[model samples]
Target: MSDPLRETDENVVPQGIDPLRATIRTRFRRGELARAYDWCLEGLKHYPDNLWLKHRAVLCLTRSGALERAQTAYAEFRLHEAHYDAECRALGARLLKSEALEAPLSDFTIQAVRAAEAYAAIYQETCSYYPAINAASLFVLGGQIERAQPYIQAVLEQSENAEQDDREGAYYLHASRAEAFLLRGDMQRAQASLEAAIALDPDNHAARSITLRQLRLLADHLTLDLTGFQALEPPRPAHFAGHLFAVGDGDNQMTALDEEALRVRVREALKTAGVGSLYGSLAAGADILVAEAAHDLGLPFHAVLPTPSRVFFETSVRPVSSDWSRRYDACLEHAASVQEVTSDRKQVGDLHLNYASRIAMGLARIQAAALCTRPLQILLWDGQDNQADRGTAHDARLWRLSGGEQVHLDVPSRVRYRGAGNEGETADTPHFSQSLRAMLFLDVMGSSSVPDDRVPVFVDAVLGRLARACEQFAPGLVYQDSWGDGLFLAFESVARAAEAAVTLRSEFEAIDFEALDLPASLALRIGGHFGPVHEGRDPIQRRQSLFGSQVVTAARIEPMTLPGSIYVSESFAALLALEAEKAYRCEYVGRLKIDSQKQRQPIYSLRRLRRPETSN
Candidate 1:
């Protein structure tokens, strides 16, 4: 039940027609057209009046080269009297214009009858140019260039009147003029008109495709070098004739002996090198025999053991000029050093988003787990505690939802809140269940140097604020997990999550984040997804956690969200609609794929911050 157009099979009736139009423009992208068409038909049987579904089916049929069938289907849709007559008409007109039929079609066959009607209703309708345009296309297709002249001229005059003075229309008009000019061997005017068309729409795929063909033709005629404009760049190697080795208790690891063995392995591996590795991190090596072998073989001897080597010697180097503004600045001073290549790109660049997402997801699971089952508490200890314990306090926090309210119960004093379920049996309750789950997401903004003695204190302050906020709103909301910078929380309802997110933003933004020297201002982007999930009982495995497509999509939404924003799935928004009105902005981000057979589901973004004012 994701997309409204996605209908189940047994609901269909043979008498009903599926009006599915293809939106994917390329044949290569239509791999599942048949399946999509079938699905549309199933949907049509249940909702026979849906124009979009019918239009999509018609488009699919036409694009599959089933033109006659497409024509018939279009007629059927028109007979049913759907609300897409204008669109149907426009597509029909294009097809007729392309084919240039000799006999006039019946009124039902003319798809864009509305456009024709509209034109006639307007001041001074003329069929002279319209028919001539179609006639010229037919003549040109039949290889009768001379006979098409009058038709082409008639179209040019009519187009001038139809286009008025819009710049957007000028290029199309010029394009038609150029085609006629080319047919007549008027190369100068053709070229001029072609240039004008390109100026109007640089990225117009059709124009670009045609322009490329024309350029290639001109290149062939003049015997010119067109290779300079090719899309590919020259290849460069990380190291020339270098030993390719892998460590970690493997035979590939280098030893003090067996020079020949190492040399053979390196040569074998290097033979398979294509563009060389895009990026890599290697360890250092100080073996003299290895170094001597590299020196003798004219190979780059970069360290391959203790990371961050500084050697560079590779064959077939990329050429470069000294000018800084050229395609690539090849100045010797700025070339990648051996050490730079040895630094793992994943460790430095890839982990940021990964850590953040994992933290957010993990926290959401914890909250959900707590809500469905137990009175979970997140005991967060800071640097001060760590320092006092010599970094052994394991600064942790507890978050959970109990009773009908949410709560963030934390450490020190035993703060017990009355939760659902029987009294003594409650402590033994499972962490995850079938109950509704909430989500919590956190974003960290401040970085401060907290000595071992002071770290616990710093963590405590942050946890205290979170704990306080949960208490003020809903009780028993448990801490889910922490991303590198932020935290994730789970709740019983989306309203609770939305309220928590807004409150977190208001509180976090009000803080003096700059007091701690950090790279950038701290910010947050929060998003939540709700659906059926398998909840785990154990805190470690947390199987009761939100899993599969819905969770991943919710995680992705946060990245697309602006800082201090909270985005929810349409399901969550609908659930919240019956409660209090939300102050946040909402948007429909169309349907997204959450799983197989689930598509076009609505996603909503709830904006928390106001648009910023720019200084004049």
Candidate 2:
């Protein structure tokens, strides 16, 4: 057997889903259901691996009044396989909703009974509100009203406790309540619930469509029934032209000709994939060429440095070429930001280089995952495993986990080259853009005073407590970083981020100092801020680091808080005020100036509203 794809292969097949977004809505709304259905079927032929389009095809077919065809396609959906998880099962249950409406299923039919059982399974596995509602709908449709009422009651109890700020969660909760009311022929209550659901997510196409249909049916004194499909927003991975790439090379110092050859390969791959950004460390060989190519294209090139700037420059950078330091400086100058892991001077050994490469790859993975795109790796090696230099081979394994293809730029001894890339260019200025997100900063107050032998135990205990606190409050902690006694975390919403800060204070209070620290001064001071952050890699650390004004605001607010208390910026307070399940109260602390150039920002002290224990 021989490998079909090689290092120089340029034939690239792009995976893009963004085109289907507007197409589905436009075609369906125009009453062009057949065309929409055809488009989906044709797309799946070319892209047979696209599960989303297959699901879309079934929905379009069902909506077009082709019941039998839709049912067959739905049954054959790949999601029904044993390998898919509860979430995928939930999606299937959701898609089945529309077809069930036009079914006119009788009480004695096998299909009707099986439909009800499937919904039950989905509800049991996911604990999602919609599935429970759908199960009740099935029972009601089969003239089993008594069985339906209990599910409605369960929904009411859960709705009272559900977090209202979860846009998607709240949408399903209110919509399901509407479905229950509709089943009972209570049009008034049903209409009100639908209105509430639509208010939560104005962009929800299904909610709007169903609401309009319900209004028309109510005016004509027609009976209400579900269309079957929940039509909540479908989860789609990102489809972008550009991919983040990594550069790794052997210990063999690449010559000027090797650098030029590498540049040609990198440039071709970037052009072929239409890459928008680059992420990696800046060593003498392949790294410099890729960086140069990325810079030439006016793309965002991020440089991840493994150690302190001067030490890294002194050993790994400057020694390669006196002019290499200037190129390194140029890369830093052009960067949107710089992350320095440690300032301590150390040898720029192979181990550090290996560690640095891993970090760079991690950053690339984070970027690709965030956009729902596959990560890419670009290796600079001759495809030889002579020694465990831990550069190209390690990257190849990492590339598989990252989920993308690779372009190996072979560095042979005899290689031809065109004119070399400019090694010195410092005149260029950087253009930067970063999205806003909520950040929480927690600094353990004075853990450094602990004896040298006890420091590790103290740090471990603090980290353990922090982990437990996050699991309690922020169930899905997305990003976190730490150094010494300080910890930094990031979240997509203000509610969870704020809850984490408040929970840390409350949870720490319940901890007795006698057990772990043997000191009373050890306490946690927390701060929270909501604003924009550049979620990119720290050049020194190699992993993703959150930075910018928001991060600075959070770090500054942390120290201002009273020991064992949480402080949040007014921006955070504004967001907390919007949450229906607000777990804490904030009293204005006053405006405090952090620095001379920075304006004085208002701060609020947060206190937890203890949750009452549920009666079992």
Candidate 3:
């Protein structure tokens, strides 16, 4: 659709000083909700009363699946603003609709009806086809077809009369018409309108995704056939993994001919999978081959390196051949984005590669979710599960556990590679006990504002609850410490860390601050990171302590996190994806500069997934 904020700017901010408006709009349109939300927050800091920015901020939260936060923000916005415009009202209704969709079955129809009325009221005030179509759809979903007829008729008439000069507007208009026809039980016209809508903006995957979902919902409710829409589905994002060629091994080493043949197979598999984007490392052998195929197909390649580029090149690329090294360099140069899972200057063990592979898979899944599609895993394997710790075998198994479609290209049995061998370690390299661990840092918000008299109450009510919760996870705790309002915890696994974080939040939220004579604003901000860390005995604490740059990174992430929310580093989220994909949900919250050094990391808001009920 045309920019709603731009059209309404005259009623909000002055034209000359509103340069941030365009940037925010562009980011939001590109599905970068976190970045757009950050920009909106920044704009509001300068112009606190800017209605457009407030609306956009709430919109970002709603789109990012932070419905509770979005509801709170919209409530606060309404408290500050005297008037509610059509856009603001529509936004509130959208929030209601989103929540209604997730409501329990017994409560869903009532909530959906309420949301439908809210949208209908907006449609009545503005004669907008967007809200009218939504009202009709929600009514139909709520089993109020008789009540939906008027709104459906209104949507059809208004959408037909609407201007179609703007491509986005035209697309939505057609989509609205399609929905209205479907509601009227005219399947043929609905399909034609849907096709027209898709034809108008074929490249706008986000918009097409919305249309597809609405149509699917209508088809499900009406028991209509929707198999014809399968062809319009968006291309899936992919994660790739394979063996790194072992150099100077004459017996089973892959020759030039084998490499070329493998590249052809990789390209064919990518094409057959209909992959729009690729995520993986850029190491020599199969990784480089996949990157080259992605580049040739004009697909975006996101490279996830286990360690720093120089170290990865030295260990994984340079050992193969100069030609392979050059190929790796070219892939890096052409990569859409390159993210290092850790800042380690040297490869420590198989942990780094394993971590990077999981991160790549998680990122691809994230991208696919955003596009309303599935993630595909492509592996080059020889049907052998030799390597147990880290290799193509381990990655393939992880993918299977995560429950996704995978394509395996069979490598010749003669291709013997040094899978997770000690090829990267040198004699001079000192080895210390190292393992991948999840670190958590938590700080109490507004701790300084607490009166000294109430400090005892805070200690009893707040810190006490945190201590009790940590005790429940004692078996998984690697290290734990608390001082004043700050707590640091190390967990043996990402699953444990995630469970602990969520449990702590739940425990704290259950506390009664008002009854304890403490500030109601008191809440905890938590941050987590997963990476290889040095485990050693502490001289001061007289206990085992976890220390490394990763721990420092986790500490930096805490101060930036929103109060009462758990924000984790990308590595932490990736581990959760591999180990606890079915138990936790990680929503991308954009990249943030975590320190004064200007180092940035992608952050995700973590929460537990609701379990499905079992039928008796």
- Top model by TM-score, which number? 3
lDDT per residue for candidate 1 within 1-616, as digits (tens), equals: 1222222332333343322232222211222233445555555777788776777667554433334445666788772354335555445654453222222244322433332333222212335443344345444534454656676676666665565375435656666665555545556666676676656654343233333333333334334443432221111122111112222333434333443454444443333331211112121221222233333444333321111122121100111111211211121222222212112112222222122212222222222221111111111111123222111121121111112111111111221111210111211236533334446556553334434564454455554465566666556364365545456677766667777878877776665534532234456567776433334554676434544343455565565544555666654553343222223333333234444554334455554323211100
* Residue-wise C-alpha lDDT for candidate 2, range 1-616, written one tens digit per residue: 2211121221222234555535554544433344455556556767787776776676665443344455567677755773455555654664455444434334233444466668877777767666677677666655566776777676766775677666656766787777667766776777677768867875454434444443333323334443332222211111111111222243434455545665777778777664556677666555666777777777666666656666666655665566566777887766533444322345434444444555456445433322223446766655655455545555566455434567666665333121122232211223333444668888888777777887777766766777766765444466887778888888877777876776676666776767765477778888887665556667898876776655777888888877766788765654454342235545445456765675455566665533211110
Top of the candidates by lDDT:
3
Q: Estimate the overall C-alpha local distance difference test score of candidate 3.
A: 0.79
What is the C-alpha local distance difference test score of each model? 0.39, 0.57, 0.79
- Clash totals for all models, in order? 72, 10, 0
Candidates' RMSD to native: 27.4, 21.0, 5.5
For model 1, what is the C-alpha lDDT against the true structure? 0.39
Candidate 3 residue 289 C-alpha distance from true site, Å = 1.1
| Comparison by lDDT, 2 against 3, better one | 3
Work out the TM-score per prediction: 0.28, 0.34, 0.85
Model 2: lDDT to the true structure: 0.57
